[model samples]
Each structure stands twice: as C-alpha cells, then as structure tokens.
Target: MTVQTTPAGTPMPDTMEPEDDDVKIIADIDEPWLPSILTIETGLPTMGVALGAGLLGVSVNSGRGPLVAFMIGLFSAVLVFLAVIDWKTYRLPDAIVLPLYPALGLAVAAGVAVGAITPTAALTAVISMTAVFVILWLIAFFTGGLGFGDVKLGGLLALVCGLESGYAAALGALILPMILGGLVALPLLFAGRRKHEFAFGPYMVAGALLILLLPNVLVPISRGSLFH
Candidate 1:
C-alpha cells in the first residue's frame, strides 16, 4: 500500500483523493489561505501551458505599442490561467482575481508616470471598472445567475479594455461577454441543461482580450476613442 503525493508534495489520499498522476497543482504562492492554489490534473504539460499563454498574450495586444502591449500581454497570460481554472472548478479564486484590482491600477499608474498613458486614460480605466462592477453587481443581485466572482472578473476586464480605448470600449467589453455567453449558453439550453451553471470568466477574458487586440474593431461602433 503506497500513498501518493502531488508533484508539490501535498498528500493525496488514495481512497479519497485523485490519483497523483491526474492533477498538477498551480500555486502562485504556497500559502494555504491564498486563493491562488489551483489543483488541475488534466494531463497537460506545464511548459505547454506557458508556451500557449505566451503566444496568446503576445497576440492579444501586440498592436498596442511596446510598453502597453507588453504589460497587457503579461496580464493576458494570467487570464489564460484563470480562465482554465474557472472552467474546471467553476470558481475563480480570490488569490488571482482579487489582486488584479491593484495590479491593473498600478499598471495604469505606471503608464501615466512614463507618459505612455495619459491621466485621462487612467481615470477612464477607473470609471470602466466601477461601471462594470456596478452593473454586474446589480445583475447578480437581481437575477441570481451571476456570482460575485463573475462581477469582479467583469470589472477587471473592463478596466483593461478601458485603458485600451475609452469608456465606450469598456462598455463594449461588457456587451461582448453577454453576447458571447449567450451564444455559448443557447446551445446548452437547447440540449436541456437549463439549470446548468457554466463558467463565465472565459467569455469575459475573451471579450477583454479581443477588445485589446482589435482596437480598430469597435472604433466606428464606439464613435469616439478617448484613450487611443
């Protein structure tokens, strides 16, 4: 009789726990109380994940100029991680989601400090976050279909999208998610999973990433690009 342990050496109960080979643990930190701990045993290689994320990040904002694109790229990479974990667990841990509040603000601040981003853009980002958060908060309160996690993630996505364009893009980010989520959900509903809960973070991330990558897309639709 042998006991198995995670690659990180966390114990796995043979009777009650998944097999050691079945999961890879991702901890942004090893702290037990942190929400960054993610145990996903999908048989995917670590290097593969990193490679894919890097490609996605680069592709997402490569047109935003070097500095902005680089930072957005890094954040997009993180979004990839969050998207997968949220899909698998149906929960977006606070460890990753919570920090984006400060991290995104700081990134905007850094941009302003260097003159890459204007103060006006920074303010727009803040407004974007607040607006999305408020709207989603109200939706979650009224509909009971959205969770706090979705609300927070939606706001962060708006923050980045706002930075990329303006308040209009941020608003577009919210709409895109709803549209995309509905597209994904309609089929499931027809398939008879009406009460089924699905992960919404991935669509949120996709909307933000698309907003950043395709800055020209919503330009005519947005009417005025404040940050651009």
Candidate 2:
C-alpha cells in the first residue's frame, strides 16, 4: 500500500484532509445601524415602566391635589429610572443618585413654600435620612450584602417619604424593600440559581413607590398601631 501526501508536502494518513476549497469561513455580519435602533427600542420598555410608575404616584397623591401629585410623579420617575438602571447594570451612578439629594431639598422647600409640610416635618425628614444612611452604610460595611448605591437610595427614600409622611413611614419604607428583596431572593436560593448576590435597588425603589402611593397602609404599620 502507498501513502499519499497533501499538496503542502505533509504526510497524510489513510483518511484524507478536506481541501481548502471545501472549507468556507463565514464572516460575522455587522449591522451597525441596527444597534442604535435596537438601543432605542431596548430603552422604551424601561421608559414605559417608569412612566407607569409615575402615573401611579400621581394617582396615589391625587388627594393632596395636583401640585403634590406632580411632585410625587416626578420623583417616582427618577426612582423608576434608578431601579431599571440598577437592575440592568447593578450599579447606581452617583451622578444620578446624588442629584437626588438637592432635588429632595428642593422638594422639601417646595412643600414648605406651598404650606404642604411644616418646618418640623422637614427636620424630621433630615434626621430620618441621616439615620437610615448610617444604618445601611453599617450593614454594607459589615456584611457586604448591600451596596453603597442601596445605602444612598435608602437615605433618599427616607428623606422623601419621611418628609411627606413621618419617621414611622420612613421605617415602613425601609422594611418593605428588605421584605421584597428577601422574598424574591429566597426562591432563587432554593432553586440554586443565585448565590447570595442580587440586585436590591429595584426592591428599594418598589418599596419607596409603594409607601409613596399608600402611606395610609404602610404608615400605620410603621407606627405599630394597626387599629389606629
């Protein structure tokens, strides 16, 4: 038996190698134009989600009149945006979350200007924000369970909800988020899909929105007086 060699002069086994002409390399097709369009499309769902939340905030604050409703709606819009970004990226940009501090101040000032909130209420809000921030920061530092973004978001929620409602309301706001996050994470843990790390900002945002929308229900719970 005679052994054949390849055109490149390499020795060939009994099985012959496929010719270069028999092979075809397909280049990855690029659609540069589609990405910009897809990017826009991808963002629409997030915007719609945020807008729905804003409308809910408006409806919830309807009893307080249009101006307050509008303010809540605007704040809810920001919250929804933060929640979506954090869900997708697991990061809450300081640029987005930090401006909320001054925006919250302006919100308080607006409430004061319109006689919606008393000076004492504003003071309580500041204290509540500080307390929440410290507590969450400590949790993140010790356990590394929550991120800095969550801490900042918690403070923002405490300020906004506490100012509008009360300290009890702030407590309720914080509690609800933890509950929501835990509820979702528990199932994931049981199914072995996740290993402790999860996006918490969305739950925080949800809790804040819920508290903003239904202070009557959450505030009483926070006050520890269901009958009252």
Candidate 3:
C-alpha cells in the first residue's frame, strides 16, 4: 500500500487516498511532560555538582583558569549522569553522551584560543585520562573495582579532564570518591556486613566534583604554590 509521510503536528490524510503496500509511514511525536520532569529531576543534581566543582577549581587555581575547570566539570557531569542512569536503568542512551563531545571540543578550543588553557596543559589532560583509565581498568578487571559502565564513564571523564588540568585533576576526582566510599563502607563493614555491592555512580560524581573544585579544597591542604 502507498503511504504518505506527514510532518509532525500536521493532519493525517483521509483513508480514501491510495497507498502503496511497500511504503511505511513513520510518525513523529513530541514527548509529554514526564520527560521534562525526568530531565529536570536528573539534570538538577548534575548542575549542582558542576557548580560546586567550578567554585572549587577557581579557589585552588587562584582563579587562573576557572572557566576551563568549570567546563571540564560540566562535561564530567554528563558522564556522571550517564553512569547514574545506567546504574538505575541498566542502559546508557546516546541522548546523554553524544552532545557532550562537541561541547568538550568547543570548550577546549575556546580555552586554548583565549590562553585560558595552555597547549601543554591540554596534553597533560590527555595523559591524565589515559593513565587513570588504563590503571583503573586493569584493577577493575583483576579486583572488580568497577564494571563496563564505569570503564566507559572513566573514558568519558578522561576527555573532559584532559582538556582541563591534565592527569592530576582526574586523579583527584577519581580518588575523592574512593576515599569517600571507604569511609562510608568501613562503617557498614564493621557493623557485620556481608555480600554487599555498593552503587558507584554516586562516588564517580563525587570524584568529578572534587576534581572540579580542587583548587578551593586543596589550597588549605597544600598551603603553597602548585608544584610542576
């Protein structure tokens, strides 16, 4: 049967019109309010994390490259969102990840053009991501530190971090959560826990936030100029 394709929101043709048997009509529809609610509900937490990380980076870096750090944090937030959704729903849809590539690329290019990020710093960022993923992936494989979702998330995180502060920042982000997880899990383990599986997405989010905001948090601890 012959079929006519109609634009979304356009009126459908009358049944009397002739149709080809081989034609297939694809219908487009708008999402209802639930999607908006879900997006807001999901996006708000990620935004909060991003903002917090940005402030932290500004403080630690002495406000040298706050925008670059903020952009990195924002990109990390997308990875965090994907990981969280996958943890909850067991699927990481392309809708959450594809848009981030362009954002990261543009942010990096802009930062470099503006001298907000040095080319050397950008190279370090790449190394930082690579070291973290390779080391973590090996550990996770041998010790089950994480799963495939985390592996993919780590790689995504590397791209963002590589464009910002290099490997140290990424390490800071990755380590923050592990430390937090240990503190939290220690109590449970001591309380006679058995056969437990902790949700890791939250920690990954925390780590990224720590990396983003390290300038603020690290200043007091480091108590001096950044070395190297």
Give the RMSD in angstroms, all C-alphas superposed, for model 3: 9.2
Considering every candidate listed, which one attains the maximal lDDT? 2
lDDT of 2 by residue, 171-215 (tens): 545788888898998899899886656889989988888788776
Q: Taking the tens digit of each residue's C-alpha lDDT, what string does model 1 give over 1-228?
A: 355566686765545646546553333433332233233453244335645665665665566556677777777777767776677668878888899889878878888888888888778888888888998999999998788989988888878878855654554458778888889999999999989989988888777766665565665455654565
Question: Which sections of candidate 3 miss by over 4 Å?
Answer: 1-70, 76-102, 158-167, 190-194, 219-228
lDDT of 3 by residue, 147-228 (tens): 6556555655666645545544555547665776688778878887744666665666566655555544453344454553
Number of the candidate with higher TM-score, 1 or 2: 2
Rank all candidate structures by their TM-score, best first, as comma-separated numbers: 2, 1, 3
Best by TM-score: 2
Number of the candidate with higher lDDT, 2 or 3: 2
Worst 10-residue lDDT window for candidate 1 reads 30-39
Q: How does candidate 2 score on lDDT?
A: 0.76
